[model samples]
Target chain A: MKGRILEVARRIFGQYGFHGTTTRMIAQEVGIDISTLYYHWGEKGDLYEAVVLDIYEDLREQLFEVEKRIHGLPLDKRMEIAVEMMTDYLFERPEISNLTLFRYFAKTRHASPLDFRVPEIMGNIAHSMGLVSDKKQLPPDAKMKMLAVMNAIHNFVSGQNFFLTMLDMDEKEYVKGVKETLKFLIIPAFVHNGATTKRA
Target chain B: MKGRILEVARRIFGQYGFHGTTTRMIAQEVGIDISTLYYHWGEKGDLYEAVVLDIYEDLREQLFEVEKRIHGLPLDKRMEIAVEMMTDYLFERPEISNLTLFRYFAKTRHASPLDFRVPEIMGNIAHSMGLVSDKKQLPPDAKMKMLAVMNAIHNFVSGQNFFLTMLDMDEKEYVKGVKETLKFLIIPAFVHNGATTKRA
Candidate 1:
């Protein structure tokens, strides 16, 4: 019943958005009473947090697996593995991805508290980048660049329609755009500037 | 009176979203009768469309200026220009940016027609890329990737609170992230693959 409530809640949140959605509506959608939801998750926002946490856990597991798989690979290959993992993970769960990405942007309004795990994930990526690049005194600009790229990748695969419209790209072409964008936009700024070695 | 109505409509629509906001409320907010809105915008949906169109026009004009200014620059320089324009555009109009971006991802149970000039903008960028790249067979995935990057840039520059919390990045870091992200994540895939130069 708990899992079922969450599933229904996910769909409700995805469709109606946070404010537009409500506990009673979710209960009705799931064929349960409003009391049942309160029993399970306490409040609507609580339920939202639960749903978001569930999605974040699943994504974290996927990222961890990708990181494990890419161990000992060449730099480029590792990057590709990371890209593929990130893309596939996001694409597979586009709705949840949208929720997360949107939540990230919406945080500026202090509309809601941010997910606690976001910082952890960003920190992990930053640490990884630091290890890859041995250069001391990395310019202030380099960090900004890294965050921007990560944000871009996150928004792209999260199923936000902004990019699709902006590019006027068909679905297949959209995927291809990701690959090309990764190569051209991400590499020159990060790989050489970011990496300890600048082979390319 | 017409301008006042539009402003009230923007406020209500932004705060309550499409389904949550209504014409009656907008009229009340404007201290006028609901019928006054009808006189100005013809209908509720039309009012909504006008608000959205206003944003589209403003964004298009800003971006167009950036495009023109950087027309003669190299890809790197052009990317820099894009980053700056996007950053400035989103920050300058945080409310409109938030509403438009939120609307971009809002899901409808039914297929709905999309408005806004985002599609045209996306196509313009893709066409520009096509002109620069000789690749005959640009895949859908590639296009999507481009979309993702663009969305990222948009989302990042908007300086939404959620992003600040999740990434632990301030405005300076956020901009840096955008640049680094473009360099590391985007440049590599496009440049190394030589997809840009590949002839059809």
Candidate 2:
């Protein structure tokens, strides 16, 4: 029951955002009494935070698996695999994408607890891409370059529907095109151009 | 006063989204009575649509300026100038960026009245980039590649604060890095590599 409530809460939060979503709506959707819902999750804020954290942790695990699988590949090959994996993951679970965009526009004045987890996940991916060393330290220049690459892929996947409508392409063709374009952009910047390795 | 309402509506709507904002709030913020606000813009929906249209028109004007400025330049130089102009423009007027993310996540069930304007804007950009000729018809492959590039830049600038926080950099440094990285990625894909002009 708790798991089911969390699942529904995530979808609602992803779609409607914190201000737009109400505890009553979530409880009604879950077919539970308001008090019962509060019993499991203390407040609306607590439930929203849980939903956000749940999404991040799931994404982190998927990224970790990608890192593990691509452990010893060369830089170019690793990037290809990472981009492919991330694109598939994002499209399949579009709620993450929606939540990401929601978080951006919602503009909550305080920092989210989930916010800190992003850099750690990015650091793991950056290390896998050879943009940072095993020490997980990125110099200023490499940090910026890696962050740019990350932003491109993140936005490409999150903004999929908008792009699909804008470009007027079917899903299969759009996904394939994104993969190719991402590779074209990223490989040149990070691998062939050697921008990642150049120190600040 | 009507213009002031529209401007305030754009910022508020961009930040809070449609459901999160109320007509009363907009009216109060504009320091006008509710009837006066309704007189200028008939309903909440009307006001929201006006705000959205206003944003797109402003952006369209900016893009037109870029197109005019970059005329007669070689393809690579044109791309560099366009990316720089766009990045700076988005970062400065981040309301457009926020509204864009809002529209994506909001997922209105019907086709937006504003949907048609996107392709028209993209067509103009494609012509300027030489991805489409004066004929203004894009091959399917060119269309996809061009859209992917557009998405990348759109996301990069819109997702700026999120990326800035994730990468733990000051805003000035982050924007500069994005400009450089966008050029590095876009130049290779569109101009040097000939990805755009290569037919489907």
Which candidate achieves the best DockQ against the true structure? Answer: 2
Report residue B81 deviation for candidate 2 (angstroms): 0.5
B119-161 in candidate 2: lDDT tens per residue? 6776777766656664256655666556556666667676776
| Candidate 1 stretches greater than 4 Å from native | A107-115, A127-150, A160-180, A197-200, B7-16, B19-39, B42-44, B109-112, B116-119, B126-146, B165-200
Q: Residue by residue across A87-181, what tens digits does model 1's lDDT show?
A: 76676667666666556544321244534665455444443433334333334344455456555566666554555655566676676666556
Give the alpha-carbon lDDT of every model.
0.61, 0.74
TM-score of each: 0.77, 0.89
Fnat across every predicted model, in order: 0.56, 0.42
Q: Tell me each candidate's i-RMS in Å.
A: 4.8, 3.0
Worst 10 residues of 1 chain A by lDDT: A129-138
Residue A59 lDDT, candidate 2, scale 0-100 = 78
Report how closely model 1 matches the true complex, as a DockQ value.
0.41
Candidate 1 residue-wise lDDT, B84-124, digit = tens? 66666666566566566566676643444556655555555
Docking class of 2: acceptable
Clashes of each: 66, 0
Please write out the lDDT profile of model 2 over residues A89-168, one tens digit for every residue: 88777777777667654665345555446667667767767566653665555665665665566666767777777677
